[model samples]
Target: MNEEFVLETKGKNRLIISPNQYCFIKLPSSGIKIVQLRPDGVISLGKFGCFEVNSVLNHPYGETFEIIENKQARAIYTDAFEAGNDDEDLEEENISEAEISSKLLSTDKENKSRLDNRDVNDIGSGVQKLTSVEIELLKKDSELSNKGKGIIEKLIESHTNFNKKTVHSQEKYVKRKQQKFLKVFTIEYLSASNLLRFYTSKDFGKIHELSEESLGLMISLADVRPGGRYLVVDECLGLIVYTMMERMNLQGEIVLIHENEHANLISLKYSDYSEEEIKKFVKTINWLQFFEPDNEKIKFPIKSETEISLLTAQKRSNYYRHKRNAEITNSVIDNVKRGQFDGLIMASTLYLPKLLPKIVDKIGGSRAIVCYSNNKELLNETNHVLLNDVRVINSKILETRVRPYQSIPGKLHPLMTIRSGGGYLLWGLRVIPGDKIKATGRGNKKS
Candidate 1:
């Protein structure tokens, strides 16, 4: 009986159990698996249903979860992993509102008994019931896609304790972390500036640059305000998005123009808001994806008749109307020049000095925030380009590192391989808007 716990994997690529907490479970039988929760919950994949271990939580950590099928007609349970085959099915079928509502309700008494018998304390000592309204909200939000809805539906349908009240309460609890201005998506432990300051104030760690605190530092430095338009690029699992969502007013919008399929925007899984609330929150931001063509591409050469031409007939009497606007290739640079953005934030591993200028050109009168790796060549080249451009006001590089504290003196372990660049940041703003200083006729004017 060690403290270690077990998790099962399902057909999904990953089932987000907690902000940072995750475990991949391998099925002993079929390929179909389920991702088990550390404390209690278990999310099934594909056709398989899911339930919690609250009834079994009191059992020892190493205790195996048996999915024994009853001879009587009740429910079927199995351990198998489908290679995201369900995702393809999800894209094809559109789940009805009726089905969503029905799935949100709880399962039968037998399942309830099973849940009660499981380790309730392990499920979470603070777990509370969710209201019907909250469950409805979750149903709505969980409707991201067929697969997304199915996951939520299966969870509630199998677990008796999982009602609207519990779902809603859990959502509130999970989402509350966003309010505290901390990154929820990090796998590695990070020391943020605010947290570091707290540590120093409490005499925890030696005063040094806190690498883990970069997000807090960047947020503070950017000075993001209400109603400000920002051009941002971050692969840090939407930590920046969560921070912005918390800091920004209701009217604020964060346009995420990303290249990756599973960017920070898609990775946002909330436990606080119901599926509906999460969907509503997701709808607020504009996802200007470069790869996916969920919508027809906005054609180039803006013409008056182009809008009408863009409208295609879905059937004899129906038509598929699309918004025909400037393409990203043609209009992105121009959009930056029109002063549409209040600030610019770009964080990526790729070096885009040549293309970045185009991005900066569009940023008229806004601060340019760039994040780079420890590799000086890439950053140096970018720095040179920024200096050449008159719009760039000032530029500096900030470095951050995390040092473990209060550890046993002789404890030793192998070093871990972290993502390259070790969190290096490059920040700058527009050069213009300043009073001209009189020259003393000695040398060139200082910026």
Candidate 2:
């Protein structure tokens, strides 16, 4: 019923960038940078540029903007023409076949009256004539003006054989230059896929190299949805919890078990869900308390407000603290004892053989039990144990990967390099076993 909870429940609108929501800024050359949109703040894009948060406050996601500096205020270019009026305009209107052919020729041949037959070494940096110092000066000037078109044009003019490359090669060269000098960036909403991408670029180890596809599959195989109670053990810095929450849409409850005294849900802080919203859905308890909660040791009588007022301040504080802990411990123990969790999901480093037996019974009958590990060997070991257990059925080990391709027109091909692994999943269904059958001397019979 809270506004933050409702917003996440109903899904965010792509047309508006909300305050405190994580979003992606697609840099011209640096891929994407994920940033939270803080109100009335400045987002510095390093050497590219900086702009006020208000510039993109209510703009639609997926729209690109070019940052431009102003003495009085920061400005952005949203239209193509506003970006530049030099080579881009020329390329559109004044390109000729003869010029393209000439550009494709060698620099020495281009200097002649016509194309000449001569071998030319093209591997080195002999095409451009601008000195590093001069280029840096141009970059400084462009930064001051908050425009890169002029700098790119100047570089192209300085190229010794700008008119000697093929049309496609020329276009590629221009694009590369633009990437180097352009101050443009695109805004994207922070979905699961985007978040994974951001983290993968920053630090793959943090999320255990979990890809977007693998994550989606894990959630689907676990049957995570609204109104379901899930027992989760997340060791990927709360990535699994965030994904589950996205799928659940703030509708269900998550009983999270952690190895530490306090759960390390650091990743969730960057998520769009507020603290209140997350508290409503996620309940965390340490492994010790979850497995061996001493409810009686912490139990105490609930004191009335008037009665507590009579006690000293220090005593009252201690009493309330113990009461809170007791309530939390009791709640966790009661939920585990209920034995009605719809699913059991874990992505921890603990031995699955030892861990599963301790918590597998917490899941309800005909429910899912999914465990994810970056190493296949770990899942393989878990698979064998789950297959032998009578309480689990249809155990399987699965791996999901996403192959990337260079999508250039007329030159499409698989990328030469890509992230090698997307980790693996161990899946099974929890079931209730019936009475066991006993064998007689010559025939099978019930005991």
Candidate 3:
């Protein structure tokens, strides 16, 4: 494979892990943690267990590794495996009452009678005989053998009404217990979708509640791809730019317009792309420099090396700063003046009407203009403005959402709670305007 392909696949398909690359260290019951793997390292998963970084360094992404305290016991779980269930292959007759009743107590007559009379839907915590402290003790003692399998088995044995539960409910109880006690975690590559999920879960404010589906639509509508020159205004701290870069496969140039003096692409640091790769694809310019290039300042001549060697340290520093700024400013201005971009993508909190007009004209004819806003009312107002402007055509606002469902067989249903509000996208196609044409007053003449 080529260098780019190999880099992209390092944590994707192949089982090789590289140093200094970010990987998701998922935990049982707990959520995911994005960690940068270093050579000769150790990662602690808290209550689950701690592991040597080298143990998983060379493993493939998406494989689950179980942690064990004993070196010899760890031998069986060393193979990175995918966790799954054989429930689909199980027949109803295959389930035995003895296996289900292993956790129930027949000696307690009153409790047994109460469980016998209780409805299936009336399940409660009182059915489990093990207390919270007992479960914790069990967890402490079960770290060696099958990781936490012993703990789960003991908990099942202590559940008084486990046998009374329906097959589906029984499976669910086992699954929940397994998730809590299992000392296994899966490693995954840091893709754009994964990054969005990570930030959304960790800090929704960072990404402005932007979901993977909404981001996918934005990229689709904007026609983001390799070798495409696009104009972007990212208020989400380079999330849009990062998505575009991934879509472009680290190719093409993006002219990023920012309201601040420097672009705040803070989240880009978490991405797998190197500094050189990001620099190759993204170029930043403030609104002031982009809208009005200071021609006089940029026209200043650069001092030769010999002449600069004669200057003071502070003067030399200032001189170099001016030279670099002038070059960058001139480049941005030259590109803007040369021609329009392939598309325009904006994700800002600014008023769309005011912002759209300023940059919409810069978009090349037959290109797309996509704007993202969390507020529906803002996009609604922007749509009205686009309808009146002749330079834009087919203006519309779209909202996309993803509702997740439980994939379990025979018990499949929509999840009780799911992430909502992926925001809205305002889409319009940039076009060249024709000459003005007026109609004569034919009706008045006939009258």
What is candidate 1's local distance difference test score? 0.40
Whole-model lDDT per candidate:
0.40, 0.72, 0.70
In terms of lDDT, which candidate is strongest?
2
> Which of the two, 1 or 2, has more TM-score?
2
On TM-score, the leading prediction is 3
Q: What lDDT tens digits, residue by residue, belong to model 1 across residues 10-70?
A: 2221222232222323332222222334554444432222334343333322223333222
The model with the greater lDDT, 1 or 2, is 2
TM per candidate: 0.41, 0.82, 0.83
Model 3 score (lDDT): 0.70
How many Å off is the CA of 412 in candidate 3?
Answer: 1.4
TM-score of decoy 1: 0.41
Off by over 4 Å in 1: 1-211, 237-239, 249-251, 260-264, 269-318, 321-338, 364-368, 407-421, 433-447
Candidate 3 residues 1-447, lDDT tens each?
113212232122224556677877666564778888776678777776777777776666766666766421121222112132333343445332222222222232224334333455566778778889998988878767545667767876787666666545565566677677777777777777877778888887767778889899999999887778888998886888878877776556788888887898987887777686676567778777777765423786878989999999999999999888778677777777655788999888889887787788788999999998888899989888777677787888999988866765555677898876688999999977654421332222211
Total clashing residue pairs per candidate? 46, 5, 1
